[model samples]
Every structure is written in C-alpha cells, then in structure tokens.
Target: MEMENMIGLTDLLAAAIRAWKQICVTMLVFALLLGGYQGYRQYKLATDPENSPEKIEERYQAALEDYEKRGEELQKKLEGQEESLASKEEYREESLLIKIDPYNKYITNIVFSFSNIDESAQLFRYPNTAADYLPKKIRSQYLELWKSMDVPRDLADGRYADLEWKYLNELISIPALEGELLSIRTMGASAKDAEDLAGAIFAYFDGHRDAIGRSSAAHELSILNQSTKYVIDEELKTKQESLDKEIEDLKTGIEDTKQSIEDLTEPEREDGYSVTAIVKSVAKYVALGAAGGLFLACFLVCCWWIFADRAANSFQLERSVGAPFLGAMKPSCPPAERLAAAVMGERRWRDPEQASAYIREQAEAGFPKEGKVLLLSTLPEGKAGAGMAGLASALEGYAVTSVLDALHDPKAVKAIQDCAAAVFVEMAGQSRLTDIRDLAAQVEGAKRPVLGVIAI
Candidate 1:
C-alpha cells in the first residue's frame, strides 16, 4: 500500500481538521449542553441554603450566643461559691472532690523531684526529657488501667479505651514548667483522671521517698539546717496567708475575663467556601466541559473519517489511485458552470495557465501532435465536459472531440478510435478511484490506453 493509503500523518491531520469542520454543529450543541449544566450547577450551589453566606453568618451568630450562655452558667457557678475565710476551707475540701469522681479510674501518672533536694547535684531535666525517660511499661499502663476502670476493652472498636489511649498518646504533650518546686503531677484520658493520677503518683513517690532521700544524702544532706528551715517555713507561711484573699480575687477576675473574652469573640469558619471561589470553580468546570465536548466531537468525527474509504483532500485522492492530481474543485463552487468558472472568475469556462499546463503535460506524455484529434471522455457522464472543453481549447494545434456518457455507452468506442488518443476528465473529490479504474479497463479493452487524467 502507498504511504497515503496507510494513513500518513499529514493525511490524518487534514482529515481530522475536516472532520471537526464537518461535525462543528454537533460539537457546538454538545458544548452548549455542557455549559448549561455547569451554569445550573453553579446556580444551585449559589442558591443552596447550606452554602449561603447569610445562613452561615446566622449559624455563627447562633453558636456565639450559645457559647455566651454557657459562659454565663459557669459565672453563676463561680459566684455561688463563697470566698469568705469560713468558706475557704470548704472550697478547698470541694476541690478535692476528684476522690469520688468516677472518671478518675482512667488516670495514669509520673512524679519527678522538681527541686534539687541534693544541693550539690542537678535534679530532673526538662519535662520533655523526663517524659522521654518514663518507662515503656508505664506508658503502656493506660490500657491495663482503663481495663480495670470497667471501660470497654474491645480494642478493635475505635470508641474503646484502648483505641482512645492509642490516639491520645499522639495528642498528649508534656507541659513545660518554671522555677524550682517539689511537684507531683499526673495526666490521663480526662481532667478527673489527671487529678486522681496526681494523688496516686504522690502516694507512689512518697512510698519511695526514704529510699530516694537516703540516696540523695549520700551526695549531700538534703535537709536544711534547723534554724534556716524554721525561718524560711515561717516566712513562706506568712506570705501565703497574706496573699490568700488577693489570690482568690485574681483567680475570680482571670476566670471572668477569660469567659467574657471567649463569649465576645466570633470564631471564623475557615472551612466554608466563598461565593467568588465557587463561581470561579464553576467557570473552570464549564470551560473544561466545553473543551472536552468539542474534543470528543472532533475525535469521533476523525475516527469515522479515517475508517470510511473516502477522499478528504486532493492528496488522498491522488495517492489512493496512484495518479497525478491536476487540481481540486472547491465545494462552494456551483456544479452548473462545470466548477471551472469559480476558479477562472468571469472568464467563460476556461483557465489559460491551468489549461496550458494541462495540455503541455499531456503532449509530453505522448499525446498526438498538431492537427490530430484528442477525444475527451469522462466516467459516469458529462459533469466535467465544460472543464474538458476549456482544456481542449488550450491544446495548441490539436483539435479536441468529446464523447458524453462515454463509459456507459458502447457507441462511444467508435469516437475514441476516431481520435488520436483519449484523456479522462474527473471531478475531484466527487469521483471514485474504482470507477476510474473500470473506465481505464474499458478504454484498454478498446485498444486505447488512457493518456492521463485531469482532476478539477
């Protein structure tokens, strides 16, 4: 097969462009439908209540009011607790209510000597380092502790205590502390757990305190001198007593300010999509849909054009029949004027330069010389006769004769024999190669090989 017959790159591209043009109306319809769908989606999103900016702000306002209401309730609770010296002891007793708290069972703990009990030696490092030094067995103890607390131990389920412990380990942070003080602390799944764990850790540390003390005393005496200790203890006791009322007032003030600030500030809904952003997204979708629709139409049309054995351009027609293609006839040209007038303009039926070239090439290909007759014949009928006549007029000294409907009529054979040689004229793009081959066979059977073909 010829390269063009096998679908060369240039031929495929031209067919694709032509196919796109042929199916342009369908492509436009698809594009319009896609664009309309995109527009509708955007309209729905813009009008939807959940996405509406007004509804979002209303929800935010409602949430703010609810938060304020909660803060007000907390304030009432704080106010109900009296701060008098008589009530001070009672408040301290109530603060220890974690003892009865059911959630305390989930507690876990670690205690470190925050102060340098041995004045000659460094004590605990940073809290992070301390946390890192915690035994792996202790870290994993949350599971056993949670199981003992009568919580679910179905570890496969995410809501169970074991699952909670797994995630909580990642979220838990070892808080930093300042200054030097002997502090026992605890933390766990809940605040009540933390409080209970702090007490447990204290008990645990106290149990080992004598052992720790003996070890520290080996380096240096941990206990201060009696006189100095007495003076420091008394001074600290007096200072604490003096500041108790002020500390209570500051605590109340801090709580009130924090609650008020939380109620007054509006939290931003960062997850919400803006109208401008949604519109831009919709526009992008619409553009992509339109482009995709157009490409799909082109691709479908191109596939059909390629598979169907039809000529898309002059080159394909030439290569398909392995013939010299003279020229092409524009589709817009009216077939009435033999399609020659469109290329020749107002000049009646003839193109001088084109006709001269056609005649010269025919003469070079062994067309009989001056004063001989050259018969013009065409397949199917006289559709190309006018163009043939025009070319014949430019045949220098040879006189041209034509047989209309020559391929289908047997009487036309006599006319071919009367002439020096026969030339076949074909309408480009409209005529098929098989029909031309059949016409050539008829001429060859009649003992006159066709000189050449002129495509117009």
Candidate 2:
C-alpha cells in the first residue's frame, strides 16, 4: 500500500516517473516557444532599417564628420590660445614691471629756483608775491627745453636700449610750474646713469641757456641742485608680480584646454557579426525556459496529486474514510501487448471475493445473514463502474441491494435503514477521498455501521 505524506521524496519520485510524459511535453513546448521567439527577434533585428548597412554607413559618415569638425574647432581654439599667450608674454616682458630693475634703481632730483636781480638766493622771494611769477616764467621755458631735449631718444641705442616704456617714462619726467620751486626727478638703471642723466640735463640747458635767457629776462637763473639718491620702484615691482601671476594662470588654462582636446575620443561602432553568439544565446534561453517549464509541470502535478483528494491505496483509503479496508477489484488495466505491459505500466488489484467475504463475515457476527446488504457508492449511476455489479454478483447467496451516490438517493436512505449493514465501494483516481469520508460519516450518522471500504 502507498503510505506517508503526499510530498514524501520517494513517493513524489514515483509520481514524477508515472507522469514523465507530461513533464517532457511541457519542457519541449516551452523550449520550442522560447527558441522560436529568440529566432524571431534575431530576424527582426537583422531586417530593421536602422541596422541596415547603408544606414549604418551614413551614420558613421555623419559621426566622422562631426569628429573632424570638433577636432578642427579645437585646433583653432588652441591656435588662438597660443597666439594670445605669446602676445601676452611679449607684452608682459615689455610693459609690465618685469623688465624694471627694482633692486638696482637710482633716482636723481633736480631743483631749479628763481631770483630777482636784487635778492641773492632767497628761499622765498621777499613778500613772495613775485615768487610765483618768477618761477612760472622760467620753469615753463625750462620744461620746454627738457621735453624737447631728445636725450632719451639719443641714448635709446646705447645704455637705454634694453629699457621698456614703463622704465623709460620713469627715466624722464615733466614737472608743473605751479609750485614755489621747480623740481624734476628721474629714475636711472644705476647710480652712474643717474649722475649721467643729470649731467645730460645740464648740458642740454647750457646749449639752450641763451634761449632760456631770451624767454625769462625778468627772472634770473638760480642754483640747480643735482642730487642723486638710490631707491627702488615698489609700485612697479608690485605690478610685475601681479602680471606674473596672470601669465601663469593663462599658461595653466592653455595646458588644460590642450589636454581636453587630446582626450577627445571618436564614437564607437559595432564592427563585426557572428552567428556563434546568437546561437549560444538562443540555446541559453531555451534551456532556461525548459527548466522553468519542467519545474512548473512538476509543481502542477504535485498540487493535483496532493489536493485532488483521490484516495491512492488501501492505507490511504482506510485513514480518510475512517473505516476498515477490505479489498479492490482485480485487473483494472485495459488490454495491452505483453511488451507494452512489461515496459510501460501496471495497476495493483485485490481479489473481489476477499472483499465480499469480509462483508459476510461482518454480518455474521451481530446482524442477520439472510438480510439484504446495501452496496453503497458516491459516483453517479452511469459512472459507477460494473465493478459494483460484479461484486454484487460475486456474493451469490447474499441478498444484496446496490445504490449509487447513496447520500443523494432517497432510496439509499430507505435501503440503508432496511439492510443489515452497508459496504462502501469506490474506485481509485475516480472517487474522491473527501466523498468517501463524507459518505462514511453519513452512514455512521444513520447508525448503520459501515462494514468496510472496497477500492477498485
């Protein structure tokens, strides 16, 4: 007899073997469906306009053109940057204080004072009212001589050749004649140059001394102070530092842009084709589908086996119906060739005579033996197989009465009341275990003791 819970490993294995055809068919169906879908997808991809060779080539050409255009723009940008950087470098060297001698600078101060013919070297002209007029009259002529001296231009090829405009501007200056005295200052590359610039100023004045006298005869020429002092150009030095920092920042930006242009990459394109990968992919999907279908089929079979509630064997039947098991019909399988019978399947059958004998034996103990025995079943009259009739015929001497679906039959109620005892008859795989249980309850509830269950 089959025994244990529905999911017991050994029993489940046996059930799977019995239902192997269903599992195989499910797997085959799933594999074919998945493989067909994969092939269809591959064919669709191959036929798509977007994937056509001409379309792909057109896209490649567009991409290549864009790439070349980007490269050209980058090159132009780099050229512009380099040009700007070079021009800035030249300007920074020439205009910024980088070319100025901050540490080795020399300054000279020249002060010219005016005097009346009667006042001898007066710090302030007596009353000071004539002081402004005298200085202004002479200094204006003095400045004109200084600016038009051409001293710097004459020295430009010699000692001042390396000096930029910022430095050259410091080397000479034009003073206003709005003060008490006239003071002009000049910066020089060295102490010697400072003294020499002061001398050049004096020499130019000496040559233009007649012109100076002709312009300001009302004012007298006074002592000139040519005092040379050593000092640094701090403001120019600060500007030079600032310009250096800007040049460094520009250099960094150029380098970064250059690196970015270098790092630019061309778009990627799929280059080759192969059926090997496609075949492998299809195989993988088919295998996975088959495995899934196999598991699903097994699960369905297991659910039907467990919950369909069809009593499997004598042990299972007795427990479900709560009645003693007698026996089942013999040779229930249909005819088959010997080879098929041996190789494919078989059904277990119990002797029907044994079941009949048990019912008789139950009646002999406590009930009348000659009375009719109710042969009760839960199947409809038509589907309740000939096995019930055959069992009834097998009990030759007993007065037997057969009823189908006894729970629903009014005649079964009367027969069950008159009969000496009742025997439950059901076929495995066709009769439900729950029906047998309910029927057994109904019989016991009617106070007609159930003799036993007979499974065919």
Top lDDT hit: 2
* lDDT against the true structure, each candidate: 0.49, 0.67
lDDT of 1 by residue, 324-363 (tens): 5443322234353333233322212144565566556656
> Each candidate: how many clashes?
0, 0
Residue pairs whose backbone atoms clash in candidate 2: none
For model 1, what is the alpha-carbon lDDT of residue 97? Answer: 26
Worst 10 residues of 1 by lDDT: 223-232
lDDT of 2 by residue, 313-389 (tens): 45565666666766555435543322222332323334556656655565455444566678889887666767776
RMSD of each: 21.3, 15.4
TM-scores for every predicted model: 0.41, 0.42
Q: Top TM-score: which candidate number? A: 2
Q: Tell me the lDDT of candidate 2.
A: 0.67
Q: Give the per-residue Cα lDDT of candidate 1 at 194.
A: 50
